[model samples]
Target chain A: MSADVELQKVSVSFGNFYAAKNVSVKIEKGEFFSFLGPSGCGKTTLLRAISGFAEPSDGKILIGGQDMAGIGPNKRPTSLIFQNLALFPLMSVADNIAFSLEVRGTGKVQRRNRADELLELVALSGQGNKKVHELSGGQKQRVAIARALAIEPAVLLLDEPLSALDLKLRQKMRTELREIQKRVGITFIYITHDQGEALTMSDRIAVMNEGELEQVGSGHNVYEAPHTPFVASFVGENNAFYGTVISTNGDMVRVSSQGKDFLAKAGDLKDGKKHTFQKRDKVIMFVRPESIFLKDQINQADNIFSAIFKTIEFEGNLKNIYLSIDGVQDVRCSISNAVETATLSTSESIELKFSSRDAVVLPVGPLAVD
Target chain B: MNYFFNKNGPLISTYLIISIGFWLIFLIIIPQLYMFDLSFRPNIPTLLRGGPDDVYTLVHYKHFLFGSETSGERYNYVDVRVFLDTILTAILITLINLCFCYPIAFYIAKVASAKTARLLIVSLIIPFWINELLRSFALRILFAGEGFINNVLIKMGVIDTGINFIAMDVALYTGLNYAYILLMIFPLYNAIETLDKNQLEAAEDLGSSMIRTHLRIVIPHAKAGIASGCTMVFMLTAGALATPVVLSSPNTFWFTQLIYQWFNMNDNWPRGAAYSVVLLTVSVVFVLLMMKIFKVKIGEIVR
Candidate 1:
């Protein structure tokens, strides 16, 4: 049931503005792929292009080695669950589920039998006679999924199907969706802007920004080692420091900023390529907040800084500690509140330390870091 | 009870009761009761019959069903042919209007640009400003023998001689029928515009052909509008008197024209009232039947 998709440098433009510019990605068979980005980032546009709703201006889209240019949506063996569900309100639950079969001219008894089978598959048995409006939100979502799957298309596309649900239902539906994808073993191409949903449900996520594909990797890789600043800031929370590289060795580099020097691991930089810093060129270092520990508990590190506590916020599972350094703006550090009592107070001075491996030295550019 | 008689409550109740009572007495309840009472009375031997206390009898209804005799003259009563003609003509006009309006309404709702939609809507409404009689007369002048149409046709060498365009049913079909056609198209356009374009695309994506998509989705969704347009055209065309009088000959007299003849020309108000009551009854029944067949509420069908 799974089909591999290859988009080779595909670009879709509407007259003047580009929706997806030179985006290229290879999705493996049976992989749960998700396009994760903010709204208007062209994630849905790319999904629509793959579903043959919009033709690309340049480059080629291949589904299992078949060229997809000039193919109408109906001709392609792809099923898309729309954002609004689009269930036929006048039809019964069984009829909505059996729509694909009925359109294919299946007999009434056979269609009803198949609809009942799919209902049980979506855990919605005996719901065939119920009206669509009578179902709960979660049941309606499942009915949409069952309807899309009835055709047994090679690729199943979903466009923010859980966005309209409440928070608890959205979270619960995420698990159900992932489980269903696994059971069906089909290539599920999900599109959403929710970072948590993508990370939890996708086997591989393509993070997009401003109509461009930034990075595509597993959720762990995307969160742990982001290649671009946009990916780093978009995927999860991190602390960024502005600095300049002072020197470099085989695997370590020293960066200086505001009368302070810090050590970082050298990565992917060639000797002949133009480096952003030799002695005074500006650079930025990004470090995950959890990687920085309070100095008294630090046993191993290459960079350490002392700061005065400015504010402390008590979240349920974690406490957010805000600190102010002498030459830097306020930085936030998240500490797990495993115990009942608090450790630090406002205006108290504390030391924070991080290892060289955790600090990523990025080239300084115009893009701001959060 | 004291709260019910409070300032805001009694004020609102008084206004509501007075307004509703006025409409019920004058518009619907009183007029229907008067017509019912008038239908049962006998005509007096006078030049004009006025007021409701003259006589009580079933002679008017019996005369409507069977031929009747007055003091000095004999009159043919309402016949089955006239009733059938009214119903058949109403059905034909409704069907013709639907056929003409569907494509125009679909174009205005779906295909035309926003500016074009506004222009078409304005053009449809402009004819209403002219009096119906004046418009029908204007049509007569345009389609009569040696009128503008025949003159243009002859000058263009399409015909060697002038043709009597208004002497045929074509005049009734093209002239007065178009007003009801415009009315039908407006409601259809409103209903069709509410359809979701994405749903159509979804249907196509699900392997349904273009024709099937229209049949399964578009037409079913436009059911309410179709019912409303048909009802409006049928009711309006069936009861119309002026258009037929101007465009059609004496033999082409409509049912409403027959009712007018009994009342004014024949001076038999009771028989005319009975015919009017029957016309109203048949129109209401047909509208209700259509609403039932479409499985839509009457309110939904009209709007």
Candidate 2:
């Protein structure tokens, strides 16, 4: 029942401002795809373009290989779950789920049965008769999903639908959403700002920044092999080093920052081009928190630094150690709580090391704002 | 009562309660009770108090129903016609006001930009600052034989001569519609403004057309406001005095005019009280019937 969606250089602009600029990507049928970006980064606008609520100023949108120009939201083979859920407060859950069917002139008994079946699919069985407000927040979320699925759309677009829930419910709903997507076998295009959500559920993720797509890859690829500085910093916490490339060896580049040299992997040479880094080429290096280790815990590493331990932040399963390099830049490193490193006091000098493959070096460009 | 006192403090609460009591008793309840008493009795000379001729009777109500014996008509066609005309015209005016004000309210609340909405609301309120009587007179002049509209029509060669808008009851209809427009609009606006725009979009996104979206989502949500606005406009139009009188023509005979004539011109307070009670009772019942039809609760309407 699912159809692949393709965008050919789609752009949505409001006169002088571009909400979504020249974005082109293909979402495969039955694939769980996510657009991940910060607030106002145009991920929602891209989703709206697919759902036909917004018209792209340039290029074409093809759903199931059919052009979608001049088609309205209702005429399209898509359904949208709004950020607020948008459930009708005046209606019962069954009525809300059956609304699309009712609009198509379906009989009441059949609509009710379909609504019941959808409710069961969302794990909210026998909850069809309750008013919207009578349900808890999680129940309402499930009802919204059932309502969207009732239309049997080729593609379902969700705009931060789980954002209203608490942390525990959000985590639970994430898995449930993934399960429902698998069961329905429909193309699910999810939009969210939270990196954890994008990483956990998406079959593939598109990282967007300022109306442009920074990268499109799997969870592992975007986190471990980011193509741009924005994708590196936005997807996860990273220790950014502003430096210049002093030496290049094959796919590895050695960058020096503040007279301290570090080795990191270079970005892939695009289009089978054998591009080599030149000497004195200014670059930015990113090292993930989990990649950095205490020098004593590692056998040997390509790069090592001496840093002053500032403070320790205890997250239930992991401990985040804040450190400063040469009393200037803030560096963070995460280790398991099982490691008994509590003996180390604050402001103590500590040696840290990371493998060359753990850090990436790319050309200096825009980074994500906190 | 305790909550009120706690919220406002003893002194202010006492003052507010006393003021409300005075207004309800002396201004409203007492007068209405007096009218009720008078409506059940015959109109007689002051010296005939407690006499046989001054006894409580249904004579005034019967006079309202059947004309006076001196007129020699089996049934009171003129007064009855006027009574029915007043009700039907009032209903018509309410419907007309709703038709015109609904879109205006929607535009202000939803479609217009914030700055434009503020400007539109301010513009809607500015005309109402003037007194109703003054506005009605202005409308009369605008719709008169050689008034502004007729003169413009004549100049534009749309008509050979001026249109008699007054005699056709156009002036009265326009005056009353203008007079009670805000009553219909504000309630509708207040209701529509609180509606989530997402619901409208969701309905449309679910393959519902524009008309179906309004019928299922927007109208159901705005039902309270519609009922409130319709009830208010209907009651106000039925009891309206100044607009119908000031903008009156040969054909425009309002029920209030008859009540006024009975009280002032004929000095028959009993018949006037009877007519007043009848109009009030009918209006209240009609409003309740409308509320039932629309399935709107009084609490929702008041809210």
Candidate 3:
């Protein structure tokens, strides 16, 4: 019952400001796609556009090869689970689940039977007679899913459905939601500002910022090989060092900053290729915290550095060692608590090392700073 | 020794209890008890001559229950015909008000622009602050035989004669009863205004048509409002005397008007009190029944 969703150059403008600006993305059939961004970044606007609540100012929305320009929200083969769930408080759990069928003139007995089946699907089988207010937060979340699934719409649009739950419940629900999507096999378009939720549950994610689509790719690609600086900082923790490219070789680029020089793997750029960078062009080098290792335990490679250990935070599974490197200020190194030794302390001199391949060179943009 | 020092709590509570409790007893409970006592007294010698020597009898209650015979004429004491007429007319008026008020309340709450909504609500309140008597008199002038309505109808060639609009039931229902209807509309509008707009859109998104959306989603959500409005209108209409008295003939006296007659013209205070007690009981019963049927708590429906 899944249908592909295609938004062709969609733009939603509210008077002067654009809530979603010229966004174009295609969500494949049976795939879970997420719109990830901070609050007021137009992720919800883009989702509403797909759900037919907000018609795009200049664009075409297509579902299953059918254009949805003049169609109203009710006419589309899409169901939206709102942020608050919006369950009918006065109705019974079964009745709330079967509301879509009830509205279509289905008989009471048949609707209740169908509601019972869907309730079991969400693992709340025997609670059909309960009122919505009687259900716990997680149960209410499941009921909302059952209600959205009652219509068996081609696509289900969820607007931050997990935002209201506590942190642990939110994490547990992520797995449940992904499993449900697989079982239902419908195209799910989820909107959230939480990076963890998107990265964990979505098959592919589209990161948005200030009403602009930054990147659309799989979870790994978004986290590891982010196309833009915004994605690199937003997806996970990274220590960014500002520098200028001094020379470029076959597969490595040498950059110098604060009288310290380092080499990073040039994944996309090549040597003597009249690359876009002039000599001494400003650049940014991004390296994951986990890639930095203690120099005493490391076989030093191309990007080794020395720093002073300002503080050590023991986080049970890992030790977050904060450092002030020679050329980079306030750099953090995450080391796994792999050894059963004493914890590192503050005000200690330390050496850190990273291989050339572990560091990625990105063109320095205005978004280099946090 | 410290017992006296901790006496302030009871002292304050004692004064508060006396103030409010005594006020309630004097203002409400005492008068009601006095009325109840008077309702049991005799009616033959008339209550105008106040004395205990006049036999305390159930004759007035009997007269109210059955018809009375005076000399050679049979004068109905309770006036069942007028009583029935008053009740039926009151119910019909209340229903008509509900029909007229629902759409206006819905429009004001859900459809009107914010500025327009404010202006409309203000306009409704303006007529509300005007004295009911003055408003009823203005309506009387408008519905007079040769008033603006008949003149306009005649000038438009819709009618040849100036119609008798003032003493007609239509005038009572439409013009004189509008104030109560407006009162009913405000509460209904307030309730409907709190409904989530997204719920309506969600209904539509799920393939429910506009009529289905309103019937299944909007109206159910507005049930509390409907019950409150209907109850208020019914209660007010059932006990109303001003509109019917000023707008209708003597033959069209309402139940409240008859109750007034027993107390004033007829000097039958016992029967008047009896009729008032019955009216109050019926209004309370009806409100409770409506609350039960709608499955709404009385407190929720009221304020």
Query: Clash totals for all models, in order?
Result: 0, 0, 2
Name the best candidate (by lDDT).
2
Residue-level lDDT of model 1, residues A189-241, one tens digit each, is 99998989999999999999989987788898777766666777788777777
Task: For candidate 3, write residues B39-69 as lDDT tens digits.
Answer: 7766656554477655566665556556665
Span of ten consecutive residues with least summed lDDT in model 2 chain B = B294-303
Cα lDDT tens digits, model 3, A230-304, are 777777788788889999886578988656788886533222232345578887777888888887667867677
Comparison by DockQ, 1 against 2, better one: 2
Order by lDDT, highest first: 2, 1, 3
iRMSD of prediction 3? 1.4
Candidate 2 lDDT by residue in tens digits, A193-305: 99999999999999999999888888998898888889989999999998999999988899998678999988643333333678899888899999899988888899998
DockQ of predictions, in order shown? 0.59, 0.88, 0.55
The CA lDDT of each predicted structure is 0.83, 0.91, 0.82
Candidate 1, pairs of clashing residues: none
Name the candidate, 2 or 3, with the larger lDDT value: 2
Residue-level lDDT of model 2, residues B140-227, one tens digit each, is 8898888999989999999998888888888888888889999999999999999999998899899999889878888888989998
